[model samples]
Target: MQATRVLLELAGNVVLLLWGLHMVQSGLTRALGGDLRRILGAGLRNRWTAFLSGMGITMLLQSSTATGLMATGFTANGLVSLMPALAVMLGANVGSTLIVQVLAFDVTHVAPVLLLGGFLAFRRGGRTRSRDLGRVAIGLGLMLLSLHLLVATIAPAENAPMLRRMLGMLTADPVVAVLLAAILSWAAHSSVAAILLIASLAGGGVIGPEAAVAMVAGANLGSAINPIVEGPGGDGHNPAARRLPVGNLVNRIAGCLIVLPLLGPITAGLQTLSPDATRLAANFHLAFNLAMAALFIGPLPWFARVLTRLFPERVAVADPGMPLYLDRSALRVPHLAIANAAREALRMADAVDSMLRGALDVLHSDDRKRVQEIRRMDDVLDRLHDAIKHYLTQINVEDLDERDARRVSDVLTFTINLEHVGDIVDRNLMEAASKKIRRKLRFSTEGAAEIAGMLERLSETQRLAAAVFVSGDIRSARALMREKEVIRDLETSATEAHFARLRAGRTESVETSALHLDILRDLRRINAHLVAAAYPVLDQSGELLPSRLKHGATHG
Candidate 1:
């Protein structure tokens, strides 16, 4: 009964620790997610800048795991090079230990005040920012309260015979002690919590100095495990995001290993700094991570090169839509301006088609960097959209003949379709890709092939539509309009096929149902945009219908 009671009390405290960490993570995310990402983005210009950025953000977030995940996303997006990103992660490790240093001090007196103030602010807050701040305060209070509870619970264990024997066994085998602490920290998903438990145990005389030091080493290594295991790299969440956490884990493990054999000296050194066992553990945690950052800061480039070889960039289809023909000086001449707009419109078409061709690659590949690189090309489409819009607006319609006036209208309509195609690709299609990569999802082979076939047809039809936009070719315009129907039918067929696969108990189909349908729908949208580009040329030629049915036609 006593053992059961003690176990339950320890479990409850651990849960409280996790709950507090969750509150803090979510609260800060809501308040500063975008701004922090932007900061990290701007700071990745070099190793020094990236390291400082990592340190500053982790200090604010108080979680190296969170910073590592964010940096992974940036690397996946090609915003940060591997070397600088690795440097940022080094600083984040030091920053994470700072939380332990702060939490080790006696702060339970403020828990009640923080809880009350946070609850009121959260309840009465108008802005989302205020509410998020309230959540942070609440998290802080819970953490302090949990710590106080832990200390109280462990105090009674000092005189317990069974507890002392267990502590003695751990003290006898420092490696076992280290491994147990690592497991405890990994399970808790917060090294701070694990360290706090060790500190509390040590302060109560349930653990000695050497045992505490070994456990701290394990706890440090264990902290690295949470991000690596939970991070996108291991779960297939995203290979691009995996590098930061994996590199971090390697660094932590190396540091822990180097210090593990020398626990006696390290503990003695720490004892000189602080006689209190809790403060020693906290000081050791901070000092070890600081040493890691210092040791690896200069060699970050070499470390990055090692990770790059381990997680090399996947081969992706080269994007072929660079708009070199968009001459700014040509805009003053109406004819040259129209010609430039047409050329830019063709570039947009090429981009849309290139994105469509890569759609299947997004579905089947394990390479997250490749997936993000493809998505990043959509920025070019936005630039082309703006350039074409401005260039077309500069043309004088009054100076154009009736034929050329109609061409201007056709070109403008074509540019809008081009822009829509880019949006669907970047927003809809890429979002689905990110979801799949993040979730480690895949489509069934048959379903994947079905979507692939439709995208290819759409890409060809889009190319023809682009040609028709510039040449005003009636036959090609008619063909594009017809292919629009093909895409619509393909979407319907894929939807039905997906359901059939789901009914047959296909795991891939069930897992990727949302992804498959979304990609199909997005392709149909792209086809619609391409088809619309054909309408103006067809209408001017007297070959376009207002709808599928004539005015007097009867419904089936």
Candidate 2:
């Protein structure tokens, strides 16, 4: 009964530690997720810089898993090269150890202070970021408190012969010890928590230093496994998505292979450096990662080449309708989720652009096959729109700050407008082209040029819409709105010119006058939909007028 009670208490304390670590990771991710992504995106210029970036981000995030996810997303999207991303994994491993190093110290006295301060700030802080930072403080306090509790609970169990014998069995085989730690770390999905648990057990004299060191190695190996297993597979065909995580796992395994044989000497060296079992465990964790970083950092470029060959990018023969960047795993991180949605939305815009260009070809060539292709393109747009919409809805509302919420709305609106553009091209514009082809009608040379001009202008606006969607640049948004007016003026002028050609009694204009007017109006409508992407951005910046009408003037 006493052993069971002690075991339950130990489990509870471990749960508290894991919860505290979660708060730290989620809090920091919510507060600085975008800036951290930008930092990683900008700093991954080379292996060395990528290493630093990875370390810094993981230090803030407190979980190497989060860092691995971010790095994987980058490489999968082709935003960064594999060599730099691999370096980031190395740095992230080292960063996770730093957290353990801090926790390994006897800072139980500071726990109460952190808890009190965090509670007040979290409940009273005015800004969201402030509240998020407060949450980080609270997590730190809980982690410290749990460690204190964990040590107290283990103190009584150290004298238990059953516990000692159980631990002794594992100590008999270093490989088994390492595997046990790896499984614990993998199951927890957090090496920091696993190592902290190992550290607590060591410090409490319930486990020997040799056993602790072996567990640390196992824990490190286990931590890398979650990312590979849980990461987005890019619809299960893109092997490039696995390269970064695989490279990280390989690095951990190599380090473990090197250290496992030297466990006796390494444990002795660690003990000489620190007699405290907790400190010894923390130091070993740090030393193992640093050694891995040094060993793998130089061969990264060459290693990248090897991985690329192994996972060779298969030619993407997949369906165009599938969502490519809406990574389901990203829904836990609001900023990353929004970015993924935005990327998917861009794919929608690209499909719409294709439809617009195809509509122009159908107008001139009257090719039945091109018209069918344009209709299929609209179907692709619809699928992409639905995928983005559902993906954004999956992101937890509470996880999103005001800024991220606005971004979600913007991505949805952009994709919605592009879908409308696709509809115009397929239903209205293409139908007009079909009528001309069926009736064997041709416009006057002047009318054909006018129609071509309108299509060209709408396409240009669409290109700008994609830019505005990504950057949300006020200047570009304003330019997109201005293009709306340009397209409208061109439509009005072309309508009048077509009528003038009719008045001149041109037979071709008379035969195709109605189709000419329909084509012009549909092109103008498509431009309106394209420029709608700018309104949200302009409204958010307070640059857009609520009403274009003159100050409450009455309409007759």
Candidate 3:
């Protein structure tokens, strides 16, 4: 009965620890919102900045895996370069050591105070900042409290014959102990959890400093698995997608090779400096990570080069069915996922613009070959549109902050407009192509030149609009809105002129005149959607409402 009660208590403590950690992570993510991404992005401009950003983010969130995953996403999306990401990962290793340092201190007397303060803040505070603070406090308290309970429960058990025998078995084979620690850390998806378990065992004298040190080394290696598991998996052929797992595995393996041999000397040195066994173990873990980081920092550029060589960039087959940027593995970090979604949306916009350009080319030239090519490209654009919409829907299910929610909505809206733009181009240009092929309809030289000039303007505007959206340039975005007025006036004048030619019998056939009118309508529609794609950027830059663009007024 006593043993059963102890087991139950241990189980409860474990549950509390997991729950507290979850609350803390969620609260911090919500409180930081887009600021987290902006800070990390800005700080990654230089090596030192990247290192500091990585350390700061990991320490605040209490998870190196989270920090590494975000950096991987940034690297994959072309937001941050490879060297900066490596720098951040190195910094994350250093920051994680801080957790072990905190655990090493005897804070049992202060645990209850933190717990009380956290509970009070959670119950009485209304703001996001206050609630997030409460979560942080409660999480720290629970971590410390759980550690206290773990020590009490296991310390007495250390004297039992069965427990002693188990300890002897682990210590008897240090390789097996290291493997066991690696598996445990991987299973938990948390190095801190694994380290804390080792610390508890060591504090109870069930595991000696040597065995504990081996486990610590293994824990560092094991923690890399989380990033691998969270990387792009559905289509493994992508070079960037494949690099996620490869880079994580290589870094961890290299770290293990450098650290394992030094463990004995490091632990012994720590023992000599700090007689307290628990503090000694904690210091050893910190020293190992820091030393490993220093050793690898110089070689990281070579490592990245090796990765690039091993995974040479392959020309991806154009499959409309395949998504260009939407990878579910990104959902693990919501901000990065949103960023990926935005990138995919930009690609979708580009596809639509390309289709519109193709359509305009066919309509002006009446070329059968160009018509067929445009139809093929439109089919591709349609496939990409469906993929992006489905991807965004999946992302919407995860918990998102207000800013991310708004961004998702904006992406969805932009995708819809882009799809409509593609449809307009396809229907109008294809119809014109059919008439020209069947009847050999020909326009006057002046009429052909006028339409070609209009097509050029449309093509230029589409290209600029795509650039503005992708670059997130408010100046270019607002300029796109302004250009819409010009496109509208040109479209109206061109259509009226074509109609005048038809009424005066200057054009060849009535069908040709109808096709010309439809082509003008399609150009106008494409421009409107391009303006729509730029709306979010203008809004983000604190510009006027989209209604102003539609109404051609500054109605602020």
Which has the greatest lDDT? Answer: 2
TM-score for every candidate vs. truth?
Answer: 0.60, 0.88, 0.80
Indicate the residue-level lDDT of 88 in model 3.
85
TM-score of candidate 2 to 2 decimals: 0.88
Cα-based lDDT for every prediction: 0.78, 0.86, 0.73
Q: Point out the worst 10-residue segment of candidate 3 by lDDT.
A: 547-556
Candidate 1 per-residue lDDT over residues 195-234, each given as its tens digit = 8888888887888988888888888889888766654444
Which is the better candidate, 1 or 2, if ranked by TM-score?
A: 2
lDDT of candidate 3 over 1-556, digit per residue (tens): 5445555665576666565565566667767746776788888887688888988888877888778777777777677677778888878878888977887687877889988998888788887568667867887888888888877877676456566666668765667777888887888777877787787778778778888878887888888776666566435546665564566567667766765677678677878988666776678778877876687678777877777788766676666546656767667566667777777777776676666667656756668877777777667767877777777677644356556677778777877777777777677767677777778887656566666776778777877877875687766777777778888888777777777777878746354676667767777777787777677777776666646743433233
Name the runs in model 1 displaced over 4 angstroms: 234-241, 316-556
Model 2 scores a C-alpha lDDT of 0.86
Q: Tell how far residue 417 is off in model 2, in angstroms.
A: 1.4
Task: Report the poorest 10 consecutive residues by lDDT, candidate 2.
Answer: 547-556
Q: How many residue pairs clash in each candidate?
A: 0, 0, 0
